[model samples]
Target chain A: MKFCSVCSSEVKQRIPHGDNRLRFVCTTCETIHYENPKMVVGCLPEWQDKVLLCKRAIEPQYGKWTLPAGFMENAETTEQGALRETWEEAGARVEISHLFTLYNLPYISQVYLMFRAKLLDLNFSAGEESLEVRLFSEDEIPWDEIAFLTIEKTLRQYFEDRRKGHFEFHIGDVERRVK
Target chain B: MKFCSVCSSEVKQRIPHGDNRLRFVCTTCETIHYENPKMVVGCLPEWQDKVLLCKRAIEPQYGKWTLPAGFMENAETTEQGALRETWEEAGARVEISHLFTLYNLPYISQVYLMFRAKLLDLNFSAGEESLEVRLFSEDEIPWDEIAFLTIEKTLRQYFEDRRKGHFEFHIGDVERRVK
Candidate 1:
């Protein structure tokens, strides 16, 4: 940060008293600006043997397929945020069963929470941020066109567990991809 | 926030186009500052039949007993953050088993993720943010003096699951308590 949000004064990066990490400290107010990882919550909405996916109309992988998820907002539970994102991006409603997958992307400072949800009905369409929304079965999933590593991993796990006739909560990390 | 950290300009709260929530928008640079919930990660260190606890040496719940947890920082996984908090507050190292409990406090916009862990050794002492660090058996826990509701619920669930001989991942919400 170039300036303090509180005092509008210059902010410098330094380790404050009794702290080991460097933080943006204001010159005038001495306020420390701390940044933390954000949570992205969404759902794998199931309909019969298919799952929902949205083609993004926004940047950062525009036009690529992804599960309907976004940065969670304040004053809401993870489940609520997941359902809200589902409705917003896919224009569909689902009943959340349970948390299915959690992937920590430390490279981007984000934690993704994906829930297993049952789609209510087929009356779904694309929202403003989505160019299209559709259902894809296991064999129909466009794996190569998936938008993110976390979403792809979650999808693979879901199908693997489905074959085993049991679903389990999964957790793992997505490290920075070496290019 | 009164001022924008990007340009040191006055900020105003408004609903950005295509966004349903109000955010701090800079008057000069038009930067949208979005705030979201934070994650608090820690471990329930288990040794034999006892779990570790820390007496707070900081504000918010000074002197009250609690599990060793704090706001998660950037560039770290949840498991790493939990282990760091355990070491920092209780001076203990642990082998985390799995995520035991997840609690959402929407009133404060925080999510608590507590993992069940095995204490590596007993060479432990109070850390800077802890007045005392000690272990407590199920019967020895101080119910009324617990610092937060999430910790109390996790502790209770731990003992209950131990009696059942099977532990399950739990999720719940902690609504604002009326005083």
Candidate 2:
């Protein structure tokens, strides 16, 4: 931060009074600014054995297919964020299973959490953010059209684990950029 | 949204020429707008079997103590985000255990994810965002000084679970406010 939040004075990364390492310390307010990344949580809704995917009606990754995901709401858990996003984007009720895949993109400064979810029913319509919403069997997935690399990686890992009957966890950076 | 991102014209929520629920439907552009929330992740780092805590150096709850937390960076996993925050604020490394707590607060439009982390070591110092940092035994926790309600609740639940050896999982704040 260029200015201090407390006193509005110029802030700089300087050594702490008695420490050697650098810190974002404000000379006037004598405080440091904190930096944090944003969170994205969603679900991979499944029915029988097929997975749910949504076609984006918006930009950034328009028309691309993806699992429902969005930032966490103020009063929600990671799972609720996942379920709520699924409902809003896919019009589906989902019961979340175990913690599923976690995709990291350090360069973007964001983390994407996807839980394994069971599709409660097929009742759904185009979500405000979706151009199309449907379930895809393994063979029906539009792998090339997936919106983000993290989603592609997560889905790939999920399928691999399913094939191996292994439910081990996975975490990696599609890019190391901090969001 | 009444206006389409593509056409920049008014859109209708109801299905055109039919009875259906509301959605962001663009007539001219034929595109929908989708908005999603961001995610925030953090960790509960423990040292010598005691949890480490940081006094907030910023507001919303300035001066209150909390487990170190920040939003997920562009491409970090929830676990990575949690671990990063702990290390940055406390100058400590840790081993992340199971995700012991998940809270979704829709009112504020954010989700809080917390993992049980064992402090690999306690050599720590205050980061820029921390006014002070220290390890607290279970009974010595400074309950009222915590920065967020989720932190307090997470600690209480952690202690209880540790007591019962209840390593099983269950989501928190299904109905109550996440904060």
Considering every candidate listed, which one attains the maximal DockQ? 1
Interface RMSD of 1: 0.5
lDDT of 1 by residue, B1-179 (tens): 99999999999999999988889999999999999999999999999999999999999889999998988999999999999999999999999999999999988999999999999999989999999999999999999889999999999999999999999999999988654
Chain A TM-score for predicted structure 2: 0.83
Indicate the docking level reached by candidate 2.
incorrect
lDDT of candidate 1 over A1-179, digit per residue (tens): 89999999999999999899999999999999999999999999999999999999999889999999999999999999999999999999999999999999998899999999999999999999999999999999999889988999999999999999999999999987553
Point to the candidate with the largest lDDT. 1
- All candidates: TM-score: 0.99, 0.64
lDDT of 2 by residue, B60-129 (tens): 7889899988765544567877888887777778898877676665555656778888888667888877
Candidate 2 chain B, which ten residues in sequence have the lowest lDDT sum? B14-23
Report candidate 2's interface RMSD in Å.
Answer: 10.3
Question: How far in Å is the alpha carbon of B136 misplaced in model 1?
Answer: 0.7
